[model samples]
Target: MKYQDQLKRTLEFENTPTRIVSLVPSQTELLVDLGLESLIVGVTKFCIHPASLRKNKTVVGGTKQVHFDKIKNLNPDIILCNKEENTKEMILELEKIAPVHLSDIYNLDDALKLIDLYGKLFSVEKKSEALVSSLENKYKDFRHYIKDQEKLKVAYFIWKNPWMVAANTTFIDAMLRLNSFDNYFGNLERYPEVDLNTIKEDLDVILLSSEPYPFKSADIKELRSRFLRTKVVLVDGEFFSWYGSRLDYAFAYFKTLHQDLSD
Candidate 1:
């Protein structure tokens, strides 16, 4: 069968891929949810969704770098990746071992497209359709729920040392928008470092993410001290950034967040 990746690269497979290597953590979890876990021969160190997934599978490395030798040894029939998660240099090298299927997701539509593609690619059309239908229903309901909710101006902090934020043109920003949270730095592109001295204090909320930097209670306290008027909270980074099966629970989480803010 002939298939095209999000990057517009064409790939062909004579039979359903029995051996798969997923480099993106979210994509790995999505593959598992699509009933492709048994076929996953390798995954990156960050693919800790099932928690026990990496125990049996070969750890091919991280998002930016990979162990080419280990992946070549596993002999994956296909390598799954994401444009934002994996680097171009790494993708070029991964292609030499196996056909690479790439996904570029920025919003709900892009994520659903990837899910639908996986369903068709792996011949799990029913499962994919069911998942997509469920997600669409939840998304519609969530949108309705937020229609009347106050749009709180929020700044999502992803890193600490450099003080970086989600900014615009990112999956995190899309998730924040879904929650009806207005990004204070919407004018900026991608994740950009900001000067703490110049940060506005009139913001409604300051969110510290729990991944890539692991913001904890201490960080929230510190931020709260600095931004006395704004509500400072720690949020699950996966829900805001990881776009896939995890999204099945993200809307629910967003509802809780909305309720908390309202209270």
Candidate 2:
């Protein structure tokens, strides 16, 4: 079978991949949900969903760094990765071991496309189609609920120390738009760093994500002190960023969050 990755690279395989290794955390969970749990021989340390996966499989490494020896031992027929989560160097190295399918998702359409492709690749077309339908329906419902709500100018903070935010040309920004939040940093490049003070004047709400940097309530208090007029809320990073199976619940989370912001 011949398949092309999101990077526009074409790859072929002799047969259906039985042994698989997934480097991206969200994709790992998607594989399990697609009923490829037993076939998934290896996953990164960050593939925390199905929590049992960690206890069962060998941890190859993180998103950017991988243990080549561990993956080689797994003898995977196919390896899964994401353009943003895994580095070019890592994907190149993994290609030598097995055919790699890289998913690049920027919006809901791209995400649905990836899920559909995964179904075809794994021969679980029915399941993937069903999941996508469910997500589409939920998203429609959420949009209807917020149809009358005013769009809020939001600043979604993803990292600290450098003080970076989810800007334009990124999945997080796409998710923010779906929730009817106008990303204040949307005009800028992806994940740009900026002084918080410079953006405070335009932001109606400041969202602190709970991953990569793990912003807590304390962090919200700190930001609230600085931006007294803005509404500060701690958001689940997975809901806003993870573009795989986790998206199944993201709209539901967004509904609750929308209500919170409205209040």
Candidate 3:
């Protein structure tokens, strides 16, 4: 059977899935939240959430590449994938072995929809609904706190080697907007490599994420020197990047982040 969500097309199992493989780290964490820890047979090397699971689960492969032999051995009933994270070729090959659920996330609403879909797929509706409700309350609190504040003009950097910034129509941008921060690159396309000189004018903040590039404290210091007036912050990449269960922590992080910026 097929189940469709706002983010992706999920293939339903005859019953609850017994053996599952997650290609995306965030989804792996979500699976754990849904009480599928013991049922998840395989996960990518990057599926480090619930950190103990990392030590216990089988490391199938990375997002771009999967160990066909390892996956075949695990005999997963269903495979979870993300459009932006996994390559097309990888998805095609995985489909030949097991049913593949492809999730395409562009914003917060899509994330929430996927959570609900997962609940239905795994027969964990109550758990998923409760989590979503908690997240909604947190988001409401954040809005209430920032309602009267000035929207700070900020640039969220995701990658560094080529200097790419999160642009419009992306999850990160949506999160930034939710926190009442104006994305400086909102006019650009997704994850564009922008010239620093282009964004040197009137920028309020430069956010450096902890992953994809792993921006360290030193990097923040360097950025501070370059953009003397703009505040440079080392943002938690997971809080901003992961669209799954990690969102529970993201709202509180955003609240603290906004307060830090104001101070």
Candidate 4:
């Protein structure tokens, strides 16, 4: 079968891939969902979605650093990666070993496209269609639920130390807009370092994600002290940031979050 990857390179695979190495954690989980687990030979340490797989699979390395020797030992027929998650230098290095399929995702549409692509790659069309249909229904319901509500001006913080925020070009920002929340920092290009003092006091809400920097309950209190008028909410980072199967739960979580803010 001839297949073209996100990079627009076409290749032929005579049979189903027997040995696959996934570098991106989210893509790893998506591959497992597509029922390509038996074919997966290596995964990064961060690929901890299906906890059972974590215990059994060989850990290649983290997102930025990979054990090339370990990867060579696996002798994978195919490798999956992401443009944003994995560095270009690393992708170039991996391409030297095997055909690397890289994905670039920035919105929910891209997420669905990836799922469809994986489905075609793995010959799991039924499963992929089912998942996509479910997600579509959830998204539609959420959109309808929020159509009548007032859009809240929100600031979604992803990191600390430098104080970075999700900008308009990101998947998180798309998700926020879909949920009827206006991103205060959407004008910025990417995740930019934001100054709290510069943020308007009239901002409706401030959301602290639970990953990357892992914002905790105490962090919310601290933020609240500075932005007393804004509702500081702790959000599951996976639901907002992870562009994999976790998106299935994001709509429900958003519904509850919207309700919480309404109260």
TM-scores for the candidates = 0.98, 0.98, 0.96, 0.96
What range of 10 consecutive residues in model 3 has the weakest lDDT sum? 4-13
- The superposed Cα distance between candidate 1 and the true structure at residue 229, in angstroms, equals 0.7
Best candidate per lDDT, number?
1
Q: Rate the local accuracy (lDDT) of all candidates.
A: 0.92, 0.90, 0.87, 0.88
**Candidate 1 — which residues are off by over 4 angstroms?**
none
Enumerate residue pairs that collide in model 1: none
Q: Residue 6 lDDT in model 3?
A: 49
Question: In candidate 1, what are the lDDT values of residues 1-263, reduced to their tens digit?
Answer: 99988878899999988999999999999999999999999999999999999998999899898989999999889999988889999999999999999999889999999999999999999999999999999999999999999989999999998999999999999999888889999999999999877777779999889988999898988988988889988888999999989999999999988888888
Q: Write the per-residue lDDT of candidate 4 for residues 1-263, one digit (tens) a residue.
A: 88877767776788867799999888888888877788899999899889887678889999999999899899988889988889999989998888888888888999998888888887889999888998999988888888988888999999998899999788899888888888999899779998888998879999998878988888998998988899999988888888988888888888888888989
**Could you tell me which residue pairs clash in candidate 2?**
none
Candidate 4 TM-score to native: 0.96
**What residue pairs are clashing in model 4?**
none
| Model 3 alpha-carbon miss at residue 106, Å | 1.4
- Off by more than 4 A, model 3: 5-12
